[model samples]
Structure formats: C-alpha cells, structure tokens
Target: MAKLDLRGVRKSYGTVEVIKGIDLTVDHGEFCVFVGPSGCGKSTLLRMIAGLESITGGEVAIGEEVVNAIPAADRGLAMVFQSYALYPHMTVRQNLSFGLENIQTPKPQIREKVEAVAKMLQIDMLLDRRPKDLSGGQRQRVAIGRAVVREPNIFLFDEPLSNLDAELRVDMRGEIAALHKRLGNTMVYVTHDQVEAMTMADKIAVLRLGELEQFGRPLDLFNNPANLFVAGFIGSPKMNFLQGRTDADDRNRLILDTGDTIDLPEGRFTQAPGQTVTLGLRPTELQPDPDGALHAHVGAVEQLGSESYLYGTFQNETPVTVHNPGQTTIRPGDKVALTAKSTAMHLFDTETGLTLRG
Candidate 1:
C-alpha cells in the first residue's frame, strides 16, 4: 500500500477554477473520504488524484514519487465508479478477469485471482451471471471485485453506493468498510453523504465550493467544527443556527432576534458584547423542559421507534429541530420550551461564521 499526498492540487475549466489549493495526505492503509455537497469539487478532486483530469497547478505524490505527469493507466490505482462500469456482455467471472487479461497475465493466474476476489466479495455464486441479470447490489460487488483482482496500491471509490436502495446502501457500506479492513490498502472515497464518511473514513476532508473547509477525524469535525459551514454539514438533522448578539448588559447571555435569550457558559465563550453572533444548537443536545429558558413552536413530529424528532420554529420563525429520546406526546402546533444540555452550545461570529471560544 502506498500513501497519497496532494500538495496545492488545483483544477480549472478554462478561467473557472473548481479546485482551490488543497493540501491533504492519506497515509498508507488510511481510509480518507472526501465529503461535500454536489458541485463542491469533491469528484473533480478525486479525478485529479486518478490522473483522469489534468491539474491546473500543484503536484500529486503517490508514495514518494510526484505523479503529476504519470498516465492514469500507470498510476496503479483501482477505481470503482458510481455507475458500476462493467461490461454488460461479460459474465461476473469474465469481468473480474478482464483487467488481468489485458495485462496478459497467465490464464491460470487470472483464474486464481478472479476466484479469490469473487469469494472475498461474496460474489462467487454469481460468477456466471451477466450485468443484465444481476441486481444493483450484485453489479456493485462485481465492480469492486474487478478493482480487487488487480491488487492496486490504492482504491478510489466515486459515490459507489449512490444507486442502491437505502437498505442495500447500508449493506454495501459495511461490505466496503470490511474490504478496506481486510486489504489494508490506502483508500480515498468520494461521497456527498456525511454519514457514510463518518462511518467509514479514518480521516475526512470537508469541502465547499472547491475549497477544503476542514480535514480531520470524523468526530473532530463533528464535535469542534472549524467553521459554521463544517458544523452545519457534518451532522445529521444538522446544527441549528440562530442569529443573536452578545448582551452588553449581561456578558453571559445571548439575545436572539427571535426574542429569546440563551445563557452562555462561563469561561468557554469570548466577550463580543452587542455584536451579532450565531448560536448553534445541536438537535441531540436540546431537550424539552417545562421551565426551559427558550421557547419554540412545534411544526412537525417524527416518531422513530426508539426516539422522536421534533421540528419547530422559534418566535421569529427560524427553523429548529430537537431530538428527544423515546416517544413524545408533543404534537404539531404545540409550543414548547427547550433546555440545552450542559456545555452543548456553539457560538460563532455572525459575519464570519468562525467559532467563538474563550
């Protein structure tokens, strides 16, 4: 396995720059995922690494060598595309053996490699089936198997599970994570889904509009986001941002435009008296309370067996979501007060969206 390094990597379509200078590294055996919303340059960055797209500037290093000039075929990287790009006419076994055959590998060697990869991917029983006859999930396994049979230094997956149904997507996610575990090869995955990145990546690079917003462990980005964009994008149900300003009279209170005042923790937030600040509250951290300090109007309620999610809006009609454990009697149109879990509040500068810490 080889580590991958990207130094000031950039790509542009004529005068339009898509990839801003991005410096990231995926160590040997590390699973790094590029996660962002669509059109955020995640796919463009992946193609740059694969040598499929020319770099506007900067360098790409696989292991110790700069591969900026290397052809994609010689890069020793196996890629699994979102479309499950398999030859429709070829059976599973034939498809798995195609890459090795193109390299003129011995017939016996190709047979052995295909058999091993098929079994590893649990597609051994489906070897005789053509892509036309296989399910979406099965076809995905074959595409992955084709990559595995080649045994490249690194694996690149471009939204490999996007076409699957919800249940199959979850199943395939586990399978891919397990494949990475057993093979221990460096992997770079591109997905717009933050949940997938959180579950599978050793490191995550969060991108926005071609800029690398933040790069770190999944939890690191979740717990202490570098900026408001990362905070809002990394979590499910998403973090709620309420526009407010630090109260000049009460240093520990944040006065919201919605006519609510949220208490700030002592020694944890800076003094930005009277200046507009963004208050971030996680849904999971907000709980219903009778005498809670903040008020919200419930709009909708989602009952997920073990837990409940409530969608609401504050007095100013700013949307907010709250995750409460177990079922709740709270219904739509109900007004509720919420108490934030201790130290769960996030404060950001209103203008810059940068986190405010003591």
Candidate 2:
C-alpha cells in the first residue's frame, strides 16, 4: 500500500484547459473515488495520476517518489479500463500471467501468481476459458485479476461496471468493494454514478469542469454540501431548488416565486432584502402534511416498490418533488399539501450559486 499525493496538478488540450490545479492526498490503502457528471474531468485526472496522460504542470507522487515523468509501466500502478481490455484469444490464466511474462518474471513465479490471483478472485475454475467464453462480469473479474497478479502499489478503475446490466453492475460493485477490503490496496476509482461513489469510496472527491468542488466522506458531502452544485450532484433524484426573494429584516424568510412564504429561522438571511436566492429541499425532506400551509398540484408519481417519488408544481407552476412511503395514489392534477422542516432546508446565494450559512 502507498499514499498518493497530487500537488497543483493540471492538464490541457492545447488552448483548452480541462483539469485546473488540483491538490489531493490519498492515505495508504484508502479507497478514493472521483465522481462527477460527464465532461467533469474525473477520468482525465485519474489518467494523469496513472502517468497515461502527461501532466501539463505540477507533480504526482506515489509513496515517497515523484512520478510526474515516470512511465506508466514503471509507476507500479495497474489500471482496469472501462472496456475490460482482455486479450480475446488468451485464457484467464494467460491474461493474468502476460504482464509478469512481459517483465520476464520467472516461469514458476508467474504460474504461482496466476493461481493465487485466480483463487482469490474465485475464478480458478475459469482460468483456461478464453475471454470469448466468459460472461461480461466474468471478463471484468479476469481484468481485475490481471491487475491483482501484478501486485501493484496502486489500482485504478475507470467505470469498469458501466457496461454491465443493472443486476450485474450491483454484483460487481460488491465484488470490487470486497476485493478492496480483502487486499487492503490503495485504489482510485472514477465513476459518473454517485451511488457507486457513495457506497464504495472511503473518501470522495467531486470535480466539475476541471475544478475540485468538494472532498470529504460520502455522507458528509451528502449531508452538508459545500455549494449548490455539490448539493445537486451528490444525491439521487437530486435536490429541488426553488427560486425565491428575501422578504424582510430582523427575521429572515424567503417568499417563493409562487407567492408562498417559506419562513426561515431567525438570522437565516444575511444577504440584503430583495436579493434573489434559492431554497433547497431534498425529496425525502418534503412530505405530505394534511394541515400544512403549502399546497402543490401533482404532476406525476413514480413507484419504485420500496418508495415513491411525487413530482408536482405549485399553483404558480413552480416545480417540486415529494418522497412518499410505499406507493402513492396521488395522480396528476391532484392537489396536495406538503411541509418541510427548516432544519432540512439549504440556503444558497442565487447569483453565485454558493451555499449560505453562518
């Protein structure tokens, strides 16, 4: 296991800068996940660390050595690409042994390494089967096993489960997490799926348009997002944002665009009156309240077995989503009252799109 450090790292494609200066640290054996939407530069950053992409500036260090100019093969890191990248004509055993063979590892040591990794990955029975004979998940395991045989100081995965079916994706996700626990190897995984990052990472680094937005534990980023973008990006079903205008002084409150007043606790707004702002409320935080003051017209309801998501608009057509237990009979055009606690609310400066508190 090795600690990884990125200091003022950057990358560019000619005049277009894709990765701005980013500084990050991964402790020994820590599973760090880089997550963001498409075009967010997560993969670019990962490839830079693996030495596959030349760093335009700054430095990358693994353990205690600077590896900015090191070749990918000599960096002691193995990357599992999104495509699996297995040799179609080679058996799982041959694929696992290929890297060792390339470096002229002893024949006995190569065989021993292949057997040990195959057994550890529980693919011992499929060792002789070529890539074409394996299922997608099995092929992915073979790719991972190939990495394992290298005994790399660090492992990098780039959306390795994106091609699999939903069920297979879940299964493979568990396998990856378990593999990390069993091997205790330092790993960096890049994914656009927030759920995968939430479940698998010891720490998550969120990036947007070449900038590091937030870095923290999964739940910490979910619970207390540093800004509006991080808030909207980290959670499933996403958070709802309502445009509002600050109404008064001494006591702060936002009058929703729908002409409904959302009362805030004292001192909630430090911005000037009439300042445009956004009020953020998570779906789970918005619930049906029989006697609540706020009412909305239902637009649609989606039942996902365990829970329901209700989408609707206020009388003024301001959109909102309400999370409900089980399934809901609330159909389109139905009028319903909903309420949310002030503690569940998040405030943001509309102009800057930055969170505002204290």
Model 1: weakest 10-residue lDDT segment is 266-275
Check candidate 1 and list the clashing pairs: none
* lDDT at 315, model 2: 66
List candidate 1 stretches off by more than 4 Å: none
How does each model score on TM-score? 0.98, 0.96
Best by lDDT: 1
Extract clashing residue pairs from model 2. none
Candidate 2 backbone clash number: 0
Top TM-score model: 1
lDDT for each residue of candidate 2 in 64-153, tens digit (9 for 90 to 100): 999998899999999999999999888888999999999999999999989988988889999989999999999999999999999999
- Model 2 residue 228 distance off true place after TM-score fit, in angstroms: 1.0
